[model samples]
Target: MNYLWPILILISLLFSIFRGTIQDINNSIFTSISDVVTLSLTLVGNMCLWCGLMKIVQETSIIKFLNKLLNPILKWLYPDSKENKEAMKAISINTISNFLGIGNAATPAGLKAMEELEKENMNKSELSNSMIMLIVLNTTSIQLIPTTVIAIRASLGSPNPSQIIIPIWISTIVGTLTGILITKILLRRRKI
Candidate 1:
């Protein structure tokens, strides 16, 4: 991966030089850097707001209530880790965070859930089924709000930043179901 990036950059440099667009590339680099800085600041502010709200949510009884509601579904999805309270709680928090579309905030909980699941893993080298399911769930996260995306759109001056909400809902639901179904089918085949 390290070599791949350098090679791609070199290729782009050579192409730009041959096309007499080296100046254009230089200008683009500066423009991109400026854009990145602006975007980063916007994202940082948005993240801080959501992360603070998440912290407050954790402090309140809302998390416990949500955890109770999610327990049955989580247990069905992660049967092996059903009895592990820590793992279950971490999973619930991670899922809730993802649903709120704050992936950066969800990361810590996801890592904790992975660690707890790892404790029960018989094979240290390979991931357990529950771990794989967790990965799928995180990747195909069924976002209910997708605040991060909306924030980006708003920062970019979109007329209606929330316009993509419906599409996001449909796509995330389809993606999550497809990912779960495929993971289950593949795991079943592997066992046989």
Candidate 2:
């Protein structure tokens, strides 16, 4: 499957090189690199600020309070792994990262959570319900702030970059609820 993608990309690139204008490609490449660098800087700046806030939250026992507050929901989502504290922490961190709009940070924590869950599982081949729920939650995560999008908008010189906040919040909530509902329905169907 991966080989097919590389082959297809190679074919397309060769075709473009042979038939399409090289000048256009060069301009696109340069523009893309510039955009990437600008975006990277913006993301880094915003992430650092969020990370600092997260650290303060953690140090002040806000994270522990949050964990306690979320315990019931977490238990429901991860019924099979209720005793796994490390896994729970990882899951919380992953969710928190997503809430802060730091997807790049969330990925590693999500992987760690999965690894911890895998350790507790007796059946290595079969995924746990917790794993499935985690996957679904991560795929359509709710974001309180669309930091990356705001950064992009600012970089593009938008007059009101923060104006997207309400719309993004609504969309993220809808997307997350839809994803959870669909995943639950599919899983139930599979069981039957």
- Among all candidates shown, the one with the greatest TM-score: 1
Candidate 1: worst-modelled 10 consecutive residues by lDDT: 49-58
lDDT by residue (tens digit), candidate 1, 1-192: 689999988999999989999999999989999999998898788667755766676678887897898988898788778988778877888898888776877877788789999999999988999999999999889988878789999999999999999998998898899999999898889779
- For candidate 2, write residues 78-165 as lDDT tens digits: 7778898878877887787888777876876788789999999887878877898999999888888888889999999999999999
Q: How accurate is candidate 2 locally (lDDT)?
A: 0.81
Question: What's the true lDDT of residue 129 in model 1?
Answer: 90
What TM-score would candidate 2 get against the native? 0.67
Clashes of each: 0, 0
lDDT of 1: 0.86
Number of clashes in model 2? 0
Q: What is the lDDT of every predicted structure here?
A: 0.86, 0.81
Misplaced by over 4 Å in model 1 are 1-63, 155-157
